[model samples]
Target: MNLRTLILLLIMVAIAALAVLNWPLLATPTTMSLGLTTVQAPLGLIMLALTALMAAMFLAYVLGLHGSVLLEARRHAKEMTAQRELADKAEASRFTELRSFLDVQHSAMLARMDALEARMSNRLKESDNSTAAYVGQLEDQLQRQGGSGSGGVQELRIEPGLRP
Candidate 1:
């Protein structure tokens, strides 16, 4: 049981014990003057009964309050649980959207990289062809000039660290 219930039960038990203990005293008669005449009655029993009735009423009130509080707490917990579920769903949707977006971007980047690589390869091939053509043209010119021999065509050469 909860602390509140346990405490209330203890209070009720104490009240019952007190009532039982004072049973003999409650049976005796006493007199009180109510401004006009004095009447004899079992004053202890009446007082005890009244006190017990008040205690019962107070306990009832406490129980009613506790019930109300427990109900409100349960309601609040339910609302929080629903809100948490909603937030989690929203987060999941956001992640899904983000994942899709990233996938699209990744594919686009890969395609662009592939195109760039192809272009670079083509350019390198063209450069190599051009260089080979230039070298072939130089060799053809040299052969033609060498074959025309007009005094064997003395070719002039320049060397590093030498100046004319």
Candidate 2:
């Protein structure tokens, strides 16, 4: 039992022991006084009974107070649990939002990289074609200038390594 209950039980035991020890005195008939009245009674037993009644009242009060405190504690615990759940949900939602934002950013960067690679490839092909056209025009001009010599028609062949 709790400390208060234990203490009350101890007190009750002490009172009972005292009553048993004084049973003859407690059983004797005597005149008792109230605030404005007098009555014939067994003084010791009546006093003992009144003390027991007061103890019972005190026990009832302690029980009521303990119950109210327990209820308040349970209510506080429930609020804490609800608050924790809300915080966890909010944290999870933030993580989900961050993940989606990162995904979008990553996709946009990949798209930009692809665009750059396509432009580079197109530029390399354009460079190769222009070089071939320029070489052809020079060869044709040289052939016309030298009319019929053995060295007049020197063909310029572009190797694959030299294409770009």
Candidate 3:
């Protein structure tokens, strides 16, 4: 098995051997002194029994502590997993909301661009119409001036009469 189990097993085996070796002493009855009395007992046996009892109690305590630690660790792991899931969900939701917001902003920008293009187109058309009208007026003015010259070479005059 593992190192801990191996060491524990070796310690138990050594203690058992020690107990077995003292079996003869354990069987022999002896007198023990009290405050005001004396009693005949197997001191070795009593000592061994007390040692065994103490060992059992210590082992139980250690096992109980280990079990509590293991359960606490499991509980913490579960809470961490739940917290991680919640965080992941929150992050994903934020991403989804951000994407939706970007999409709406993108559509609004496109619509604004379309409106700007339409306005630019109308301005260009208006500019072209005004230019054509000016050109027609210039042609009529040239015709009227040339009509008086009868196709002869004439000196052109400069004028500043163009106004809106």
Candidate 4:
């Protein structure tokens, strides 16, 4: 089904094929002649069966190893996925909290700006009234000194750093 399983299956098939192909070589008989003795025996089907059995056992062992590895990998992947989900949730929560804090700060800054603007407007109005009153007082003093006939100008000398 999975890649690992497929590979294991393929290996088993190859081993079986090799065993069948080598069957004739394993099943043949041989003779050994020493100087004073001669021995002969039939190996044939017995050797072939043993070789095939060993190959089958080996294939089984490899398949078991592959299955174990696949299981471990699947388990590790699940754990990592869960860890990533938790991290993402934590990051989202932190961002939401920061956004709320910034929103409150923005509102406070706007309110302070509005109050400052109002205070500046009142100060400017007071300054304008004071300037108008001072101008009127100067005109009245000029009229009392002479009705514009006596050159209603007075000059006063001042030292530096003295306020008039």
Query: Highest lDDT among the candidates is held by which one?
Result: 3
lDDT of 2 by residue, 55-124 (tens): 7898799899999999999999999999999999999999999999999999999999999999999998
RMSD over all Cα atoms, model 1: 6.4
Candidate 3 structure quality by residue, lDDT tens digits, 1-164: 89998998898899889888978978899998877999999888888888889989999999999999999999999999999999999999999999999999999999999999999999898878777767877777788888777776555543435423
Model 2: how far is 90 from its true place, Å?
1.3
lDDT (C-alpha) at residue 1 in model 2 = 86
Q: What stretches of model 3 exceed 4 Å from their correct place? A: 1-11, 33-37, 134-164
Ten consecutive residues with minimal summed lDDT in candidate 3?
A: 155-164
Q: Please, what is the TM-score per model?
A: 0.68, 0.69, 0.69, 0.62
Query: Per the 3 Å backbone cut-off, how many clashing residue pairs does candidate 4 have?
Result: 1
Local distance difference test, each candidate: 0.83, 0.85, 0.87, 0.77
Off by over 4 Å in 2: 1-8, 126-164
| lDDT per residue as tens, model 1, 52-151 | 7998799799899999999999999999999999999999999999999999999999999999999999998887877676666667767777888766
* Superposed Cα deviation of residue 22, candidate 2 (Å): 1.3
Report the CA-based lDDT of candidate 3 relative to the real structure. 0.87
